[model samples]
Target: MLTPTPTIEKPSNLVAFAFLLIAFLTGIASSFQLPTLSLFLTQEIQVSPAMVGYFYAINAIIGIGLSQILAKYSDKMIDRRKVILYCCVLAIGGCLVFAFNRNYYWLILLGTTLLGLGSSANPQSFALAREYADNTGKESVMFSTIMRTQISLAWIVGPPLSFSIALNWGFDWMYSIAGLAFLFCGLIAVTLLPKVPRKKMEQNTPLQAPSNNQKSVIYLFITVFMIFNCNGMYLINMPLYIIHELHLPAELAGTLMGTAAGLEIPIMLLGGYLTQYFSKKALIFTALWAGFLFYLGLLFFQNTWQLVLLQFFNAIFIGIIATLGMLYFQDLMPRQAGAATTLFSNAAKLSWLVAGPIAGWLAQFWHYNTVFYVSFLMIAIAMVCLMKVRTVN
Candidate 1:
């Protein structure tokens, strides 16, 4: 039988609303860069696809180290607001640097590393939401759902806007807009955010070496790593595949990605309701099974319309996995919200770090279709690991 823990006090509705708004703005800033990044790297900057992977891998490596350090500090301080503030400032600077220095590969690499470190804001935001809910008697899972939904909504809007900007103003303008947005977000964070009390912020138990919880966290980390390995291959390679393999207009790639993210919004909202009826285990199983089938289709689908249609399935798999993966780790160690969320976020970054170079090498030498096969295998392995960990449901 599970023992119940006491809930912490919740922040005022206004504070919560502010957090959500900040989440949306940051999401927009981050998403706008995604649809056009590979295009800018290869077409405008004239870098090899393999080089794109290496650059991103380096970025993720920097993010892993910086985020780990920041998360630990937030947990100890019991205040994520400061970390979020720092991230926003970094985002603003990095985006501007990336915007102006696109021609120099070394500069671009440095800017991307800073942006990667800044993106740790995503996990910190989730942790803050959890802490707020604990204090307010709100559901942590539901807040997570809402937070993720806001990001999904941003994905829907950001991509189309990014595509239009790239088409009209030039790709540099996309980074410029993102930089301004990040600056605005930083101002909001500094002026409006509240602080958690020392007592409320501290972990329930006294400081000690990690318990058995660390073991399960490790297992879950591997699970998340594999899930995102599949994601890295797709996000980094799909635009290139569509442009090079299918010979489609570059704008369609953004449309396809945006459409999929749009479809994900409802799924994310539905996740809150689903948890009331279906077990987390059941939902995660559904997602992995859907993913397995979707990646399998990637090997066969050649037509643009077919790939577009596949986005619906991809949206479902991605939405569920992203939402549940965070909640699962938080559930694993409820007290260390900062550490848990950061670990889960790092799992994805770490996967990208590894997958980037590997996927690039495969696509460079072998074939684009080969990436899908590897992704499918990764998803299958994640499913096997999920089956073994009965604690999740």
Candidate 2:
């Protein structure tokens, strides 16, 4: 009889739990800016909507191009703790710039670029989680679970926190609080993360090489880009739709969005379990098809409740797709964790880069419904692409 291969024992749950806590805190800090950043630009800086969109697009551009370079460098360096510490410090500086600047447009643009550089932590956190998994011999399930939980917590906490801060204290205080949060997370990471010995030259590999597998990896990146484009379009445009088209109050729009996000948390946790039983490709396909239907539902939405219901359904499917896609990409480039994460992160940035300007232009020329229709078409294309993908495992 053939013997079954023994599963690798995972590292201590205590360490994993601690890492998850850090991930949660990081997510909370990062997310606090997303809902209010554009509003800050418009209200505080008195910039045009077009300019605000442009500023975000530029940030995405910088992040997409620079993340790979930074990740490659990070892989070679021994002092990852120090690297993370510097990212946090950069975030603090960016926040300070935003808090102090009175000229809205210049401050918004400059602050966002600096924030873009700091936001590279998104990928670094993933890379670090993967490293933790490797060191502990834990399954990627643990990593994905931690990530989804952090993201869900951010979605749940960030909007209310941001709105409250922006409503009562002003945008400056929001940035200040975000800066302090980053500093705190950095200090915690510096003290708690275990130091591993650096590998010698022979053990280390070159950052880039052309190979057959590399080409396949590129294809995977394209798929990731498509999925994120679908997501980014929804996130960037939907709020505007709720406030402007639906004629809902800003607070109500935020609440509905928050509710949709809160629903996603359970779906994400369930997704972590489902990945063990189902093929990743199948789960992705299901999510894509479901997302397409959800977009279709948006076309028929007549009231706030209708839109909220659709958003709730959409969130569940999107959560599944997001978690599975992360795992799938990690599986594709097992060795180059940083590079793989950078590629995934850039896909997200690329989506925002494309979505912000395109959505803005579309909203200007046509109706917001047109944007939803376009998103439906994109999700359909994504579903087809996902169906055609060969199972990686």
Candidate 3:
């Protein structure tokens, strides 16, 4: 079921390695920028918490629109490499702007514009990986999980290094390093990543009446959207929660995230391997519970060691859901890799759009601890939606 339809000569292991490197580089760029952003807005740039929320909300809104535009046309292109190349170039430019400019207005204007275009890089790259595996007769699910682990690998070192650089040298230095990562990644993607021949995509054409598969995809999308809403809210608010509420040092946020990322590698690999024995729906079902428990624990476990220990659950939930959710969408829309993958990624983007403002408002109005309570509630609802999709095998 996971087999890719081969259309060309099988590629060597080196091609796979090339994709892994791209994943690593892109992950590094993301790690440097994403986690550091809240702190940058709050601490250095001196934006209010509500404004910080609006910033991410704006970026997500723009990103969801632009990435949808890309998914519309990217499927028609002859070469996937060109789309990827253009995206990385845009990402580099965005990073450069972040490095130099500290003004809030300037950042929102240029940063959101270029970076929204740049956001397509992740889904596009995933599309490329799926195509390569399909065209070369590799195990698609396993290969996709392997590609994901490369991002996990990058996170293992990326977060701590990111925070260290931002703290020690400056935010400018951090963004500069992220830009360089994209530059190197772009160069490799253009030069070495193999080009798979375009397949006919009926998925891009106008749709008929909704089928069972379409209905299921809608349910799964809502499920993932809610689950990630909790995760996104946590990622956005957890640092501030720890620093201001728990009275812990700021750098500890990096350690917790890095530890969770490290744990995600093994959890993801295990999930990939478990596909042989368990249904993806079953794994996803259990993963949502794990996510709920992680947030529940977060409400109580404010200590250093307890927080570090809790990352295992974070790893279990995030690791499984991220990979399996994407594969599930791909299975539903088999011919439309770009649309399916983008749809999955878009759920996360949409969740962030909602979560950012909510997290900001809650922290500003009520208490930081309330975010965990809301996250717990969101995942419980996600579980209910998951139960609605009985069509999943």
Candidate 4:
């Protein structure tokens, strides 16, 4: 049954703007760390590719556990303001540690793990966004789209800035900048953000209960797992590919990552409105198909410009997934907002957990370019799995 759209008041512009600001600030800080992570591990620390994967896998593994626990607490008891503030503190401290102690592999791993644990902040932020939607009786999907757009905007700015800083000053300075951003985010959380409580919706509320069967749920999980598995592979290897394989400038890594993310900003902003005309299934399926093609193209690109152009396709796929994937999960498990969000979040984490070691091993044994073939295969399989999802309409 299609529930009538609620007539409840919408969140004030001020409230929505605050969430956007937080998302942008957090993105600015973390962008410095993530895009340059592999470069630091491989170039600065002189670690083997396999060891680099191990470090990332360890980080993802720890993040999976910590984010899940934090998600549960954010759903049930904890104030999200406290949770977000604590996460920023951990991330800031981790970045500072990495900046100073990166030469020590053990310390690097420790700092990365702390950063991973702080990842709970993202899901908690999503949970808070949902709570605001609930209070205003607005659709959670709308806020999710808006928040994603803002994050994309930050990515557009962050990557180039990070790359420039790394090129001119040093990678260490990049980490220092990221740490300060987190510190600023912590301050914003304390002063500007609200402390809204999670209220229980009545049974008759418009929120639909989860309706997917076990098989359907399994297929969605596999599809999400595959999507992020490809994501994990690319994140772990793209720097090496650009620097070592393509013989491009190291800073191009940030430029490419930033460019792709920038393209997503428009798509994310429009995604909610697009769904009004096209079915969500069509959007997701088309994105998956585009992803398959994008990865396939990666196997042939011989120049930096070709690779940069191909990232537009990649950005389209990621933007759609980021904006719509959670909404799809919520449609599947509509009763539990936190659980729905975390399911997708953990899918990415778990994929990173596996992909780090596996992608590293593949790149080591074969060619770095061959990793894209594997990613192509994963996307193809995900597309096949996505076809099996039963639509509510």
- Worst lDDT window (10 residues) for model 4? 1-10
Candidate 4's displacement at residue 98, Å, is: 2.4
How do the predictions measure up, each by TM-score?
Answer: 0.86, 0.88, 0.89, 0.82
Task: By TM-score, rank the candidates, best first.
Answer: 3, 2, 1, 4
* Candidate of highest TM-score: 3
Alpha carbon lDDT of residue 66, candidate 3?
87
Tell me, by lDDT, which candidate is best. 3
lDDT of each: 0.76, 0.71, 0.83, 0.74
TM-score, cand. 4 = 0.82
After superposition, candidate 3 runs with Cα above 4 Å error = 1-10, 42-48, 201-204, 207-210, 240-251, 300-303, 390-393
lDDT by residue (tens digit), candidate 3, 1-393: 112323343356767887888888888888888878989999878999779877887888888888878876777676777888888889989998898888999888888788888867778888888987887778888999988998889888887789899999998899989888888877877766777866455434543214767777888899999988888888878889999999999989878887888899999999999988898999998798788779889987889999999999999999998898998887876656777888898998899878877887898899877888888778878888887765445
Better of 1 and 2 by lDDT: 1
Q: Residue 350, candidate 2: how far off, in angstroms?
A: 1.4
TM accuracy, model 2: 0.88
TM-score of 1: 0.86
Residue 67 in candidate 4 has what lDDT?
A: 73
Residue-pair clashes per candidate: 5, 1, 0, 0
Model 1 agreement with the true structure over 1-393: per-residue lDDT tens digits: 111222223246766677778788888987788657777788778888667766666667787888887777777765567788788878877887877786656555678767876777777778877876776667777778888888888888887788789889987788889988877776766655555544653655543225765666776778789988887788778878878887888777777777878888888778767998887767877888888878877778877788888887888788887888888888777667777888888898788777777777898898766788898788878887776554644
